[model samples]
Target: MPINTRRSARISVIGLRGIPDVLGGIETHCENLYPALIRDNPDLDITIFVRKSHTVTITNEYKGVKIRAVAAPQIFGVDALLHSLWCLLICAFSTRPDIVHIHGIGPAFFTPLARMLGLKTIITHHAQDYLRPKWGWKGRLFLRWGERMAALFANHIICVSAALERDFLKIYPSAARKTHIIRNAPSSIAGRQKPDNDVLKRLNLTPGRYILAAGRLEATKNYLFLMDAFKRAGLDDMKLVIAGTFVDSRPDYEEKLKKQVSENIILPGYQQSEKLTQLYKNAALFVHPSHMEGYGLVIAEALAAGLPVIASNLPVHREFLLPEKCLFDPDTINELVSMLKRPDYSYFLHPVAISAQKNDHWHRAGKEHMRIYRNLLPNSAILTPTTR
Candidate 1:
């Protein structure tokens, strides 16, 4: 490894499909986090590995961080496995990063190979990917195996939320010694950026007259439940806007959802940046019906935008300390419809849930990540050894 004038380490990040406007939670996390990292530590040379199928740009850089797009096939269950292997091979022969940070359990399967090639590995346990409904038995088994590989091989593991850390430790109890909760923050809201309402105006949506939900149209998100509830609620002239794209694994999900939507229900696929912020800030209520989430970052973002949020009764939602009334059981259409019918939403004005945004948490996340990176480096002094 050749030393640069000031930089001490080179880190390679993998597992998310391209970023800066990509659709997944992991993509958003990387988009916000890596930039903050290089901004704070000018000497760190970070190269992110993005899937060629998902990347839109030919550029090699993003906000001081080097972007290396790798060729990955556009298959659902196999893409991650192949992409990670390709990246690890590249790390071994080409770029030679001091550390390879693998995001998500699916990609963490290659951690052992990375270690075998003398590369330090850090795996961020974004979620219990095995538990997601998108995967079949084979996929589930593979993801679980990936978790085991990560537990046994990675030098350090970072879990996004404490609940997620708890869940992962339960499965791989011995891995607890090296695992740490670094947390995922909502987009910064120290002072709000001006909203872009171009899409809103085009869609004929008026502020406070619509209910907004944002996330991929997956079974775990329970979009069908939300749509059914909205129809049953039948609040006159109040529209429902679901601002997200479809999941690749669930192509039929779009057709199923389309059959149920009326003129008032909007499906503006994959909103981000100013458009997403506009939707968040202007909605009468922001709802997240996800049955499983690593850290309900979308809920936190809604809270940050000063929007009232109603969510499914997931542990992650409860982790936000939201009041009972704001959460509803997804199985019971009546309960959700009742929530939709509530005339006044001012009861949701609590600061406890919005704390992630109030604090510049992305900056904190970047610092914590740097500490872990430094501690793992050869002969580096940053933190003491982890206790079992």
Candidate 2:
């Protein structure tokens, strides 16, 4: 590869289904992160390869970043595998992107292919996919193999959480020198400035009269456990609004969840923009009951909305400085129930800590990402970090 300081560095992004209204954690991360990256560092050229099945847009640009739609399957396991491979082949055969940035472990497994094609690769380890219950033995093995390949092959690894980076280095100590931790920031709440509360009216919800839990509706989210805990909490007047979409691959889990939904337990399906922000703003208490997470982006969003949270005792929860009392074991329904009924929900929350820990995290993240891109392709004329 030749170094050319006159031209803007080109970054090719993969490992996500699609963006701009997409639901998953990686989708949300890309939607916020890339736009900010280009906004601050205008010289860098970023292009995301979207899966054709999830998105149908003809436009090739979003928020100044270039977009290229690639063919993708709708099957659960095969979809990600083939779509990612297809994109990699395009990179190998056609595109001359300076760096190929892959998000998530499932996609990261293909990093060796990108490297073999003479492309520089960066893997963003979103979470340990092998830990999720959705994967069978073979799937888990594949994910594990992917993790090892990424750790061994990629030019640099970017872990979303300190916990993720720490655990990764422990498993692949030889890869320590290449891995870095670039935290995922909370998404801005769009509903905060909405003119009307019509979305709440549609759901028949009153402000401060609901318990909110938002994420993809899957078994890994522990929604059933949360439903049971909320039932026993005895908040008869307060409704539990779980705002998320059901998984296409897991019909049995979604079917069982729907059967258990009573009048008080509302499954409003997947929501976004002002609707999602309104859900966050109007809710009394926010609950996150998940078995696994890389950085827990929704938990950060709930806090950013000034809503108190009750989350699982994952190390990522502690990373946010969530008090021990606010953290409950995912398996312990009784403990979550007890916390749910407490009158002093906000007392344990550290509102000051939120700003103190990370103020304008996305802006800083954009700058940090630019720094990384510069390091890899020094001749690309990337922006230098601005002084405060």
lDDT of 2 by residue, 167-219 (tens): 89989999988888998788866324763468899999999899999999988
Pairs that clash in candidate 2: none
Query: What C-alpha lDDT do the candidate models reach, one value each?
Result: 0.83, 0.84
Tens-place lDDT per residue, model 1, 201-295, is: 98889988999998878888888989888888987689999988885647687789878777788897777677888888788988888788898
Which portions of model 1 show Cα errors greater than 4 Å? 1-6, 188-194, 379-388
Error of 1 at 118 (Å): 0.7
Q: Which ten residues in a row have the lowest lDDT in candidate 1?
A: 379-388
TM-score of 1: 0.93
- What are the root-mean-square deviations of the candidates from the true structure over C-alphas? 4.5, 4.0
